[model samples]
Structures are given as C-alpha cells and as structure tokens.
Target: MLPPRWRLAATSVVVVGALGVAALGWWYADGRAAGPLDSVIDDRLISRGEGYEHLLWPLADLGSPPALVLGMVILVVAAVRTHRRPAIVLAALGPPLASLVTELALKPLVGRTHFGGLSLPSGHATSITAQVTVYLLAFAAVGLPRRALLRRALIVAAPLVVLGVSGAMVSLERHYATDTVAGAMVGASVVCALALALDAWNRARSARAARVPLSGQAGRG
Candidate 1:
C-alpha cells in the first residue's frame, strides 16, 4: 500500500489539476453559450421544477451559516476528545481558508457573472465541500479504532453530500454545473494541501525527536 502522505500528495495533485482544468474551461468559454456538458445536466435537473425545490432546499441549506456552526462544533468536540492539536488547528483554519479562497480569489479571478454577481465557483458548493473536508480530516485525526465504522460512513457520505449540494445548486439555477464542479475541486484541494502540510510537520517532529537521544549521547561522550 502507498504511504498515507504519498496518497495525500497524489490526491492533492489530482484535485488541483481538476480545479485548474475547470478554471481554464470557464475562462476559455468566456461569453460563449453553455456547452452540452454544462447545459445537459443542468437542464435535466431543472426540468424537475419547483416540485423538487423543497427537497433540494434543505440539502443545499447544509452549507448555510447554521449548518457551518454545527459542523464546527462537531469538529471541535472530536478534536478535543482525541487531543489532536493538528486536527484542531486544521478545523479552525481550513474551512475559513477555503471560503476566503473561493470568495476573495477564485470567484473574483474567474469573474463569471450570475444574477448580477460573480459566481464561477459556487459559494454554497464551496461551503459544503470545505465543511465536509474539514470534518473528515478532523475525524480521521482522532484515530479511534472503534469509530472505524463512522469513518467509513463519513468517507462514503462526503462525496454524496457534495453531489447533492451541487445538483441542488444547478437545479435552482444558483450555479452552472461547471461552477459547482470547480468549487468541489477547489475545496478538496485546499483541505488536501493542509492535511499534507500537517503530515509533513508531524513526520519532521518525529525525526527530530528520534535524533535527540543520539545527539545527547554524543554530547555526553
């Protein structure tokens, strides 16, 4: 099996590449009409109309402020219970950083207007994606063997939640398919990068600790 760090690194590269591809497509398409790939999925979802709005609305609302607060609470409690400082720090920083990147950087840089405002990477999609990513990372950091089932469940659920939110956004005409796809990629990339950094820090600290005894022996001699 690949080392965890290597796996994380690979995931980061793939996610970043996806984000770049989405951005390039958005930029290259410019003022052109929506391509088949973008329009077809959205068209099918929207065809369901207002009848499905109520169903999707709650799923979409998971990205809202109240949901974010709840997610943060869960993250904090998990990190505290496990006494994982890296996880706690990541929980505190990751979501906000992702949101900032989406709002201040990607959205502005892409400049794709929707309903009179920038909406290249959907804020709702980013919010949900970032929130889920942080929670998963925090949970993993806990490393409770008994919670293996829960972790597996989370691993299965996170992507589904992202897809549900994306579908809701497109169905509601809140974002194009490309926007949600890009948002997912961006959010995943941000969390993956942070996770890899934390892993590297931990590995370096372990190496330093291991060398301390040898260094002490040399000094004593």
Candidate 2:
C-alpha cells in the first residue's frame, strides 16, 4: 500500500493537472494565446496529438467487449477455484470499467472540442492511463509483495510513460493541451479513488472481524 504522504502527492498531482487543463482551455477560448508563438505551439501540439490518436485504436480494442468477456471468464475461473479473488477482480473489472465510463460518459459530458472528437479529456490518454493502472493493480494483487522494490518501480514508471506519450500527443496540437492533461488527471484520479476505497473497505472489514474475536474472548473470560 502507498503511504499516506505518497497518496497525498498523487492526489495533488492529479488536481494540479486537472486545473492546468481547465486553465488552458479557458485561455484558448478567451483568445489569450492567439499570438503567433502560441499558434506555433498549438500546431506542434496538434501534430503530436495525432500520434496519440493513432495509438488509441489498438489500446481501446484491448478493452473491447470480447476481450473483457474473455478476461472475465478467466478471472471467474481463477477466483472460484483457486481463491484468487483480488487478482480476478482487478484484471476483469479495473481497466475496462474505468475506460468505458471515461470514454462514454465523462468525455461526452465535458464536450471540450478537439481535432477529431469532442474532447475535454483525451480519450487516448485516458485509455493509456487505464491500461497502466489496471496492469499495476494486477501486478500488485499477485506479483509485487515478494519484490517490493521492483514492483514499486514498475508502478511508478508505467504511469509516467503513459503520461509522457499522452502529453506528447496533446502538446503537438492533436488535442488542446488541456484535453490530454485533463484526461491524465481524471484517469489517474478515478483509479486512485477506486483503489483507496477498496483498501478502506477491506481494512474496515478486517477491523470488525478482529473486534469480533476479541469480544468473544473477553466474554469467555
């Protein structure tokens, strides 16, 4: 589990990213960056954004219905027979559920226009983020406890790569710089919240169970 301080830092990064995206969007809308230099930057951002856009199709297909169904079937088998519920749940639900909601709901609601889609947040970035997050969760569920250092490194490195690629796409004007930034922010935030909530729920249940045993012992005494 991440220490509280590290979790706070993660939350802060997401909040700042989202704010930066919103500010950039407003700046563009208000014509604050209409000068030649800004236009040049925007052009570059757009060019980079195309790379991200092209990458999206493959990544999105990974989380498509057939893939998800196959994953779930595997997870159910693993969980029911092998007692690997954590691994099963993380693999089957994490990325697909988060990515689908992001693509279908939040992206549409934000309605911040982009080169090819209604873009408040870059779907490509969100897709990449979800992919990394889901993988990280799966690794944590099954592989990380034994090699803590390597696991930690992978967790940190994966998201940064996703962010870097997404940012590159947005910076080159494939998206309004804001769109990619927002996508990264929202994607990370949602996953973090999900993880934290799950942890909390487990902790609470454990605490209750512990109390139950203690109470029974006390009554016997």
Top of the candidates by lDDT: 1
In model 2, which runs have C-alpha deviations exceeding 4 angstroms? Answer: 1-6, 10-42, 45-91, 135-156, 167-174
Summarize candidate 2's per-residue lDDT along 1-221 as a digit string, tens digits: 33465456556755775576566545444332233544566676555557465664444444345654564565446445545454456555655666666678766655555544576556666656655665554444445546789878877788676756565654544555555656666666666556556556667877999999899999999
Q: Report, for every candidate in turn, its global Cα lDDT versus the true structure.
A: 0.73, 0.58
- lDDT, candidate 1, at 146: 52
Q: Give stretches of model 1 more than 4 Å off.
A: 1-6, 9-22, 25-33, 141-145
Top TM-score hit? 1
In candidate 1, position 160 carries an lDDT of 94
Candidate 2 RMSD to the real structure:
5.4
